[model samples]
Target chain A: MKISCVTTFLMCGNFDNTLAHNLFYVNMETPTQFISRIISNDRISEGFFELSLSWDPRAPVPMPGQFMTVRVGSLAVPLLRRPFAFAGFDADSSSAAIIYQKRGAGTELLAAARPGDELDVIGPLGTPFVIDTDQSKHVIIAGGIGLGPMLFLSSALKSRNIPARFIFGCRNKSLVPDTKMFTDADPQICTDDGSAGFRGTVADYINTNVSLDNSTTIYACGPSPMLTSVNKIAQSSGARCQVSLEAVMACGVGACMGCAVPVVGGGYARVCKEGPVFDGGEVLWERM
Target chain B: MGANVDLSVRIGNGTLANPVGVASGTFGYGGEYEGLVDFSDIGAIYTKAVTLEPRGGNAPPRLVETPSGILNSIGLANVGVEKFISDKLPYLRTLPCAVVVNVAGASEDEYRRVVERLESGCLDSVDTNGSGIFGYEVNVSCPNVHHGGLAFGTDPAQVERLTSSLRELTKRPLIIKLTPNVTDIAVVAKAAEAGGADAVSLINTLVGMVIDVKTRKPVLGAKTGGLSGPAVRPVGVALTCKARRAVSIPIIGMGGISCADDALQYILAGASAVQIGTANFVNPKTAGLVSSGIREYCIGNGISSLKEICGVAVD
Candidate 1:
């Protein structure tokens, strides 16, 4: 049914506000959040930087594992918006935290954000990692900044008293955030170069410690290869798994067909609409 | 007055607020541009073309950014007629300005049904100037999908059949959108008028392609797509002029109109109004710019109202 009434207000000509009714307006009405200041902007790898942000609510609160559209340059040319998953959103009594990696113009601009600068953001869009109730144990697989979305998903799951295990993967130990939020969990970390943490891929960590039949559910967000590998293990082990799919999006809302993912059933579905989150089985991963 | 000219004109049964309306498919319904483009400033917002059924659209790689344009083969993926009426239409009613819904039909009956259904609402208004609710821009020129877009637009007789069929359903004005892929756009424009169309929009996305040299394959999953953006503006202007001479009814010109200057060129070339497509991808604020630019041009030229520029050309 249509909502009793729809209300609209234009913040300005530059900023975009998404309004929808019925299935179009899903959970988390105000999802995208922006940063108030930069906490750290140190470089991690050759071109990547491990950046942290203090969240501002005027910016919508990003759902765990959701991404935002960050504008990069002062130039009007090359005006398409890029999508990035939230690294984390752990709120304290006074503030919140988010992490991202510098990749392209959007990220480069995000990296240049100073100690007192603000960024235009739209958020908590797409289906977030579902915390499954059917399983008593949970496993997380992360790769690169794909680890970003997992951080917040982990925090949300842990606060609910859900027993969780994490497998963080990156090329070197320097890439992993200083400390995984759930310190008590002693989550597993893997580095391709053995520079730190477990000296192997996160998939290897899962292979050694996880038994699919252990009342387990898997939540994963990372590089496509890592997710594909994790998906295989989760499937064979009979564990229900949800994977976050990433795409280049124009409008975070379903208006633009720029960010579409192929489904197993037939036809294309919007990553911003049907889901950035999908059952491992429901997606035709190979086709995409 | 030498370099400036007013840019508004009459379209069907209504006088537009301006002459730079948002084109179908690009704007994705009016609300998409709510805060990005001032809803009340532009002439009208022609929503994304809606079909009888909700389409899932084509697979991955639907859009590609070219030098100054974008090649998109989105396939008109929308929420079906039922969802649009029950969900999309009500929100459109709330907009502060006129809202014209672009309709895409795969068959004659579907075309009639959509027009018949829309006419039942407040869309039946006639302003003091005589044109209101504006009208329906039957999108026969969309090249993105295979179903019905270019399917009917390419054949003049079929285009005539669809136009006349819709004209019979409602007296609320009908604008048939024509494709530029044809040998002669004016032939199709005349066919549309012969079928009783009140107006027509020229030059939907031009069929084009992009390639990934590394993989040695087409960039879009569909392999080929429609090219839009500044790349197609000249083609659109030429065709809009040709169609204007062939048909007595007003013509809505479109194809890569990103700025006010681009929009004005279409007006001077004989377009009653112009539609801005690919520009929305580059700047969501484009519609507002074109609208204000027209007004600014009008005031600078001592043009009292937008009506004077309807078909004023160099000749």
Candidate 2:
């Protein structure tokens, strides 16, 4: 624990001074850590799984783009908790879900999580995506497992009667999440191998199909390369963009400056604190 | 009768209410852990290392998850001494626990200036004398930094010289944070003691690295980082024990400590105090829980003070 990234360590300074930042997390009173029983842990597709857990209703309901760090195991072999954005949060059921791809030791352990088993969770943490008032043509894009938060955002947008051009990109048809929830989003599927809708990457689809304008707002989540591409596409179109980034975090809270992502400014930003979401132009893409 | 069991221990001229404290980098500036951890249960909160100027730290991929632990090359990225005074100190000043600013720098002058700025900068904001800035934890053992971190820590003369020089700037407490990547940890412990240090904190992270087989590249941007967590507990406990016999000054023990029992291992090995490090990432309330568990163990065993159990296992 003698480690420290001597950056602008957080308290009030991590998050930006935007209205959305204040609206969502301003009085996040009594951040609670709880143990929830796994309601279900089901594989939705090849190398992809969905975990649902009972929630402590006392804790604030997680907004779209918000994330939780789940303790996948009791022991230290898989040392740090895996931070996953909320794929779903149902206050009525008092449960939440995470859609994760089985990649590392942590998710591999999470894949084996069974119903009736208990897991520790700390959340509704980080800045949530804001529904801007200008009514810009909203475009929500998800790449592979990045679909988790974007899917949550789409449903929330629909409930608010906010329509968006939804796109989900993956390697092929087999990589797609096989869930009723995914189908509910009514997303345009783009596949690399032409096994689905539009052929090639999400960048290719944006370049060939969608015509963006200054009034456009791009909201995205996915791998770094895809996010970098989104940043570029939005930049060229002069569209405002808020990207949800995925970074490895030792401490899910702002405490550990381990989850740093390079921004346009001089110093690095802790992705766990300042964002899993940031302005497209704010990030220094070349460094990423 | 168990209610009267005392857990108070010494950290120099000042008394630590308990032996449970959070490590430097893991705890950040204490305010970062607002709603999650109860500050009342902790004995100390070692703030992140502060330098003369702000540090951008290493490149991305600063952290990598190793088995039972983590490897980090954060490179001491901090908001500099000026910002630490302006931004981080206010919240740290209000914490119920003791606040120890962990200081790091590339050169000896940078370290001196950082402490000097803190000594003078905290005057108007603080009401109680020297209460806002509790003490200093000189981070001579940080392995990730290319400059004065482990370099100063590994040499006995440099440790002694730096400790005594910084000793002149403050009277509160000077705890030299030591690294384990050395041939002899005791010589360094004795070096701090010889330099008029109030206490010594042992076993900063051991230098380690992780590689991605597919890419054939190092996982961390710095290529090598310090390893901490349960993986380093034995190394920490062993070093804590070694330093205890070498120096009479209080020994603050840390490394891979997650539980009260893990802390107890250090206390039995002669650590006057213990810190919860990587475990904070797993659970923020770990220090408080560890405190409670340690108290319960003391009461159940009919031990009057934690000092009785300190270093009991060594003989």
Candidate 3:
């Protein structure tokens, strides 16, 4: 399936141009703090959960690959906001879903949050995936909870009837999210322990089954090592790739300069502003 | 009932509308938080460090979280003073509140050049009165740099020389930002006072580092970074108290100031005004929150003015 250029513009509305402009420029979006109520916070897998938040209808629609910074505790114990990518959004319900892994104190607090609880969130922030109309295929590769942004991107592409594929990987079967949650595309699941689908890493699956062509555009979000490998593969194959990065962020806004990611050239880019999503070639993974 | 309480503060030659202003490097040029925070309610906006030339800053992983604090090695990433004057100052001049530019450099000459540029009216065409920079918060405490920053801040002789030199260059309120990394913060504060600094602000982030046990390497690209947040608040308060006793000049206190109570604590420790630093990152509206918190504290205590409460705790 493929979406027409006209249809894409119509779907994006007047904000299409502004959104497109923000992708290349840093600190374009004026981040607003929203008191979103938790519609649901359910544990989907061990040490991982999918949280749905009902936000203001007037708030800007979150784009794929963009993230939200969630304040974990009411007090100052966990003083920083944990950045989580948008896993999905239900426009009809005026809600967005974030899939997170319990990695530290912040995520542990986030896991304890109950339904109907209000959370201080700032987002729909960072750069989103830039889908080139010329690209014939959209390949989404995700590792573990990195599936958060990929899920949203896949859902958005499916709405446009854009041809896309999902390559999901996890350490084992238990770590994998329910396949039913991903209804848009039949995911090619890979597990390191061979407890699930294809044995070995997502890179192995991509190496064996996936062939990178000129028209192929790959979008990946995962561990740094996986992203580095993906970038290498895309560069060698002459295919374009965009990767969403993760870092410890203070203000999800551009002001903090807390989440700086090294650029391929010289200088650094803020993961919260310049990108959560950056061209794979543009990132300096070796430095990170 | 709390609305009538006075939050204004005297810092150098000007009066801050409130005692709550964000510290440098935390609030990026004041325009970044336009919609999120009410500028009118803020006493002042301290812009990110501006240098003589544009600095790209350090490598990746410029910041990390430790305990209740954050370690950052941004390396003073900023547009040169020229760009700030041409592009950023116009917007800053339009704001109703006071604008304080935090200036950093590798040498005294660079600092002088930046001060001269500001004083020459090159950046103040918008504000018929003068440049938008109401004051100069000379950042002598930045740990990320090699030659000038912490070096100037830690040594009394360098602090005296830098402060006295800049004092001759501009009449703008010179607030020498002091580093707590020094052996004795009071000595450095006294040096600034003797060198004719109008006021002093302490303490900048404490130099610290975090190591990744797995990689057996430093977490920050710079190997070490300055620590700021709630974890450093006690150290800030203690240094402010010590510096207050050492210098007669007005003191601006900052360090993990998260609430109004924290601001009040600084005032009582002899700070005429307080700069909200790391708190701004955790809560963008912290300055406003701290301002209101001060008001509420005053009303609750029947304190008519901040002057009455300032240094009340000191003997």
For B169-232, candidate 3 gives per-residue lDDT tens digits of 8766889999999889999999999998989999999999999999999999899999999999
Question: In candidate 2, what are the lDDT values of residues A129-154, reduced to their tens digit?
Answer: 87664655999999998999998888
Question: Candidates' TM-scores?
Answer: 0.81, 0.94, 0.94
Candidates' chain B TM-scores in the order shown: 0.91, 0.97, 0.96
TM-score (chain A only) of candidate 1: 0.79
Regions more than 4 Å wrong, model 1: A1-42, A51-56, A74-77, A89-120, A132-135, A155-163, A170-187, A191-201, B1-8, B31-38, B117-134, B241-246, B309-313
What are the per-candidate TM-scores when only chain A is compared? 0.79, 0.91, 0.91
Residue A91 lDDT, candidate 3, scale 0-100: 67
lDDT of 2 by residue, B1-315 (tens): 527877777666677777788999998888778878889988888888999999888998999988888999888988899999999998887888888899998888988999888888775442322257667899999998888999999999999999999999877689999999999999999999999999999889999999999999999999999999999999999999999889989899999889889999999999988888889998898999999999888888888888899998994
Docking class of predicted structure 3: medium
lDDT of all predictions? 0.71, 0.85, 0.83
lDDT of 2 at A45: 86
Q: Considering chain A alone, what is the TM-score of candidate 2?
A: 0.91
Best by DockQ: 2
Off by over 4 Å in 3: A1-27, B121-131
